[model samples]
Target: MSNNINRSLIGNILKSIRVEKNIPMKKIASALKVSESTVSQIETGKNSATKEKINEICHVCGCSFDYKTDRKKMIDLVLYIYTQYSNLSTDEMNSTIEEVKSNSFISCSYVRFEYYLILYMDGIINQNNEDVQLFKRILEIGKSSFSNKELSIYYDIKALEKMYLNDSIKA
Candidate 1:
């Protein structure tokens, strides 16, 4: 973990895959010959993971790190969308929205959650009912399965949905 290595997307992706494989942090720490605290910090985005560290983590979690594949592409796409969504110009934003809307590639729940989130944001920004309905369907799929980070986004989207309906005060 270093101060310069970006966290968030990569960290969450690592954590998500590790969780999916049922690999504990202690095990990953042992595998990487690092302390559990270091692994925990890396996973929680408090610290950062270098490329070598990311490879080791993906290896330990049995996740493919090959960027040529669709899984990797989708992960990168989601990461790019998540990291750049706010800074995107209107034209770039619309392009991303169209790209996401036209595709149905979901390799994992984390991706699915993020995909729906982009749609949810697009729905809010563009007032699109189809996107909103899709977001509701995703929320109904699972709340317990999401990571804490994803859960935070879920709550924010839920609140926004309520606000959109003018029922923010209700359950």
Candidate 2:
């Protein structure tokens, strides 16, 4: 999980989604058979929601939570989504970024390695220090677990980073 999807952001996302569906927090609390203050605490990030509670919320939203078990397929899906999102408007791109960042499908080592590869490319494209650092950190964490394909991408990102730095120096 990325640092971007912290407790507060998760709470906010849940709250916003509930509001968008015209569901009140009090109603959700009643459905969960919990006090309104408990739900309020979860929404404000003051308390953590159990897995069962999250599932209940998903049920209320008329959506099923997919705990993707297939690592390879999940990676493929993320790549496909990335390809499709490339041409999205800025707002849509931001939304997609947030969604990807929030999703925990990268729990698998291979998927996490692939995610870091994508993050590295994003850093190269944007030339941002934090993204570059994050990519490096992820690369280090997953270095031993990397497949040959990931190694290729890691090296490519390194080359791209050098080029970006050179261009910056010249500018």
Candidate 3:
């Protein structure tokens, strides 16, 4: 992959889908006619796979390979849902959240962290919960792996969450 391409982001997406679908690295490696270690390297962003190899990995994992655009759309949707929280009805908001969660292409750890952050911001998820802790851990561990936009969202939401919690405690 070129230096311009976000290797870790792509790797995380593929790895997430693979693990979620219970598809083994060996299976993807076999499909790509490569060794399991090669698949591991690709998934960990230690090595890059060609576009054709990525597509074959996706095919083996039963997902489509339109992630570049899908990822952007998913981020846009999350931002829209956050900004338009009051304009949307309860059902609409719930439906939108479910849509994001169900999208196989949007399974990157940073994206998932952003999703959970939005949910916490909207009061859809409680502040004290396993989901929040899990995503927070993801953010901390993968801080270097995330994009600038994603990190911006994380810091913004975290500040907002802290302010809101403080106000609630004072009340």
Candidate 4:
């Protein structure tokens, strides 16, 4: 099972987020009802987490569970929603987003929606076939980058623009 547990994207992302929050290993371990040794192993990328544990950790840390969805599921969800969101005018987009945020479940839903929006936007302004291909290429790259690093908001926004605009070359 050790081979099955090595260097997971989710484990690395969790480690990066935990470091960014400046929370101690023991604290996270306690919050997740696990041992410090387990947390340490996880942070070092020796193990991955179960989805249920990921949910509990997110609740305890007050951080969004940004990486809970697998790439295929994420892509499929975004593609389906893209069909709807693309049909809306800019004004409708703004209004719908605002109204959604007013709900109690906004935080959870918004995170997923926001993730989808970036991908949707990327698919919209495809300058050519090459541009579209690069966008998908970078989606995989983006996943790996986030595995051990926190993507800044500015970076995310810039990446979104470049992806949709075909301005960036798969970074």
| Candidate lDDT (C-alpha), each | 0.63, 0.57, 0.61, 0.49
Which regions of candidate 1 fall more than 4 Å away from where they truly are? 1-5, 66-171
Which pairs, if any, clash in model 4?
Answer: none
The order by descending TM-score is 3, 1, 2, 4
- Model 3 TM-score is 0.57
lDDT of 2 by residue, 1-171 (tens): 433333443454455446545788888898899998988877666777666776687578555444444546645644544454455444654455556567654423225545555666555655656757755765654454444655655665576677777854433
For candidate 2, list the clashing residue pairs, or say none: none
State model 1's lDDT.
0.63
Better of 1 and 4 by lDDT: 1
Q: Model 1 — TM-score against the truth?
A: 0.44
Residue lDDT tens for model 4, 1-171: 234333454555465455535667788899888899998776556766776776776666566564433444444444444444556555554454344335423223213333423443444433323344443443333344332212332245446557666677853
Q: Worst ten-residue run, lDDT, model 3?
A: 121-130
1-171: candidate 1 lDDT, tens digit per residue: 234333655566566567656789989999999999999888777887877888888788765454333434444554455445556566777787788777644423235455666676677656777647646664444433445655665566567667888997962
**lDDT at 51 for candidate 3?**
81
Off by over 4 Å in 4: 1-7, 66-171
Clashes of each: 0, 0, 0, 0
Predictions ranked by lDDT, top down? 1, 3, 2, 4
- Alpha carbon deviation, residue 134, candidate 1 (Å): 17
